[model samples]
Target: MSFLRRLTQAFAPPPRAGLDRHLAMAVLLLEIAAADFSRSEEELGLIRKQLLTGLQLDASSAEALLSRALDRSDAAISMHEFVALLNEELDAAGKRELLSWLWQVALADGRLAPHEEGRIRQLADLLFIPHADFVQTRLAAGA
Candidate 1:
């Protein structure tokens, strides 16, 4: 190993492997829910349901995961790190499904704020979700 590399490794703890995919997913969903500057009970409930049913996590585990996600989201510099991790871990269909979840969270308050839609659109771009798929997910969520 290079001398500087060895020195850095010796002094600094190894970086985390990366954000966990489930945590990344949760954080994204939370971000979408909060994009409007408010997170309603409905929005947070949908997110909690996603964690509970989708991941089959127990109530306690789901709550803990959500708590961690909130912490990560608050400290996050950009969504790129979460998106990059999700892109590496999730396939195309999975990304599409995640978009759907984001839409649901956005609409959970029964209105789509401009900023909420904008946030989803930005994430759609990062996830490489076609505009058609983005619209489809929005339609599905509204339906």
Candidate 2:
């Protein structure tokens, strides 16, 4: 009974108190991963690997989070909710680092589709990241 109660509690959702930054990151990454109009297995692999290594998530946890991210990204009409969540959760430096990661995703296939570039630029601006900084990050990421 105690074990069952603990399991139930563990599965309970977190309170919707404020914007969840992890959810935002997950959504943003999913968008970038799918920016080529079709999601590639290679891109999905990179996303999964990054979430596991960069975010230090276990396999099952990463899979679940990524799945949720994919859903949220699909449902979102604009990037406003994601930007708001990032602003609430991350400082400037953290936001920059996230931009770098997004660029890395853009470069995963050794090419950046125009649509992907456009999406990244829009997201960077929404995150309040300057164009220069965004370009520098992209160049640094070899995008």
Q: Compared to the true structure, candidate 2 yields what TM-score?
A: 0.82
Task: Identify the candidate with maximal TM-score.
Answer: 1
- Encode model 1's per-residue lDDT on 1-143: one tens digit a residue: 99999898899843545469899999999999889998899999999999999878999999999999999888887887788889899998999989989998998889999999999999999989999999898888883
Candidate 1 residue pairs in clash (backbone atoms < 3 Å): none
Look at candidate 2 and tell me the lDDT of residue 26.
Answer: 78
Model 2's alpha-carbon lDDT is: 0.83
RMSD to truth, every model: 3.1, 8.8
The deviation in Å at residue 121 for candidate 1 is 0.4
Clashes of each: 0, 0
